[model samples]
Target: MTVEHREAAAQRQEAGAGGPQAAPGRRRVALLFPGQGAQQPGMALGLYRADPRFAARVDEVLALWGAEGRAVRRDWLAPDAPDVPLDDLRRAQPLLFAVDWALGRTVLDWGVRPDALLGHSVGEVAAAALAGVLTLAEAAAVMADRVHHLASAPPGGMLAVAGAPEQVAGLLGEGVVVGAVNGPRQVVVAGAEAPLAAAEARLRAAGLNTRRARTLSAFHSPVVAPAAALGLPVLRSVALRPPRLALHSGYTGGLLDAATAVDPGFWAGQPAAPVLFGPALDGLLAEGRWLLVEAGPAQGLTMLAKRHRAVASGDSAAVALLPARPGDDGREAAAAAAVRDRLAAEALLPV
Candidate 1:
C-alpha cells in the first residue's frame, strides 16, 4: 500500500480497536448530513413510497414551505421527472433540507440514535433541526430565505478540487474562494464561472483532479456576502435552543459552541462561510469508534468520510442511508438494511 493508504489503515484500526469488542452496547456513532450535489430527482422515492412514516415526515417538513414544498414533492416523486428545479439553488436548498431532516428522523424512529452530528454546507440546516437547535419549520424557513437572497445574486459556480487546501490556495485568483475543505486531499473552490473554470483547467493541466460541482451560485464565497447580509433578519426571527445532541460545526471545523449555535449572526454568515469538514472530522475522530452515517439522499458525505485518515486507517466505519445515484433499484432499502445490520452487529441497535 502507498504510505498514505497505510497511515489511513492504521488510524481506522486504532479507532475500532476497543469499543466494539469491549462495550459494544455503548459504541459511539456520529450522523453526517450532506449538502448540494447530493440531490437527485427520484432520491428517497423508495423510502417515501414503502415507508409511510418516512413519507409522512418528509411531507410534514415540506408543508412548512407551503406551495413550493408541494411542487418539490411532485417533481421529486413523479416518474420520468426532470431535476430542473432541483438544480436551482433557490428551490434545492429547502427541498434537500426537508429530505435530509426526514431521513434523520426516520433513522431515529428506528432506534438508531446518534452520539454526535455533523453537517456539510446547507446540510447544516438539517443537522441543526436534528440537534433540536431549530425546529423543522424554522430550518425550512432559514433554508428558503437564504436561497431567496442567494437567487438575487449574480450567477457563479463551484469546482471540486482533489488536493489539499494549501495546494489549491495558491491557484485561486480574483473572485475564487475556498468553498470547502472536505478532506486532506479534497477541497471545493467557488466563484464566478469564468474564474472557477480557469482554475479547474489549471488544476487539471497540473495533473490534479477537478470537476464542476452541480450548483447555481458561488456558495461559501465572497459572492454570497450580500445574500448573507440580507438573510440575517430572517435567520434571527427563528427561535434557537441548545442542541439535544453533540453538534459539530463545519463552519468552525469543530464542535459548535452553545453561544454560537444560538446566535443568528453566526448562522447568517454561514451561507458564505467555508465548510471545514476535514478538520471537523478530525475532531469527531478524537472521540473514538464512531459510525459515521450519511443521513441524506446521496452518499457524497459518506464517501468523503470513508476517505478520511481515521476511517481509512480502520479507526472508524462510514455508511450511507441512501444511494449516491437516483434510479438504483431497491438500493435505498438495501442501504437501510446494511446500516441496520451494522448497528445491530456493533450492539448500537437492538437486534
Candidate 2:
C-alpha cells in the first residue's frame, strides 16, 4: 500500500534534507481524498490531536454536525468499539467528510493551494465542498440525508474482483454491477447481500480472486438506487455553485463543469453509478504534471496516484499525510514527521 518507486522525488531529493528548492513548475498540487474502505478507525488520530491547525479544521467541520458531532468524534477516535460501526455509512460518511476536508485544509495552510481536487465514492462530497460546489454545511446535510435514506434499502455489500470492468460485466446478475473501476485490473462488484455473494462465487469459479470492501452496505451500485432516489428531493435543495478550483468527478471520470456542478441529479445519482476513480485520476494527471497529495489516511489514494503515467516520468508525484492506520499512540507523531521529511525532500513542503 506504499509507493516503492525508487524514482520518487522524495528519494531523489533525499540528500537535500531540510533545504527545499523551488518545486517543479509542471507539478501543481492536487489533493486526493479517499473513500470508504480506504479508512481505518483512529486513522490520523495523533495528527489530529497534535496539529492545532488540522484539529481546528476538523472541529469546524464536525461542529456543523451539531450534537451528533460529539458521537462522530468519539466513535472515530475509538474505532475498535463504537456505538455504530465505521463500516456503516450512517457513522462513516459524516466522519470521513470531516477528516477529508480537514486534511485538505491543512495542505492549503502550507501556502501551496492545490490545482485540483479528486475523491473516490464518499470522498467526493469532501472534494466538492473543498472545490466550492457546495459549502461544508450543505455537504454535511447531504451526507446525513444519504445516511437516513439508506436505512431502508436492502442490506448489501461489495466484492473487489481481480479483472477489468468488462471482464466482470458478463458475470453480473440482477443486482450485481460494477461498483468501482479502481485500477487497470481491479473492479468492485456490489449488490444485495445474497446477490453479491453469488457474484463472488461466479468470479471465484471463473478463477478470478475477489475480496470484500470494508462495509455492511453496497455503495456505488444498483443496490443503493432506492436510497439515492429517495434523497433526490433533499439533495436538490442545496444551493450549488460552480467550483472556484478544478475538481474531477469520480462518477463522471472527468472535470466538474459549471453546468454539472449545479445539477442536483448529478450529486444525488452518485451512489447509483459506478465510481470511475481510475479514469478521474487520469483526467487530473492528464491536465498537467501535478503534485497529488492524499489528504486522508493509509496511503490508499497515494498508491493509486503513484500508478499514473505522470508519476513514472517525474511529471508528477504523490504523498500521503498520515501513516497506514491511526491510534498508533507514539508512532503517529513519528510517522507524520517522516512524511514531512519526505515532502521536504521533494521540495513539496512550503518554502
Best prediction by TM-score = 1
Full-model lDDT, candidate 1: 0.80
* Positional deviation of residue 34's Cα in model 1 after best superposition, in angstroms: 0.2
Question: Where does model 2 exceed 4 Å of error?
Answer: 1-25, 334-351
Q: Candidate 2: what lDDT? A: 0.78
Segments in model 1 whose C-alpha atoms lie over 4 Å from true places: 1-26
- Worst lDDT window (10 residues) for model 1? 17-26
Could you report the Cα RMSD, in angstroms, for every candidate shown?
Answer: 5.7, 6.8
Q: Write model 1 residue lDDT over 242-270, tens digit each, in one string.
A: 77677888998887767989999889998
> Model 2 TM-score?
0.88
Per-residue C-alpha lDDT of model 2 across residues 146-170, encoded as one tens digit per residue: 8788867778898888897898989
**Decoy 1 TM-score against native:** 0.90
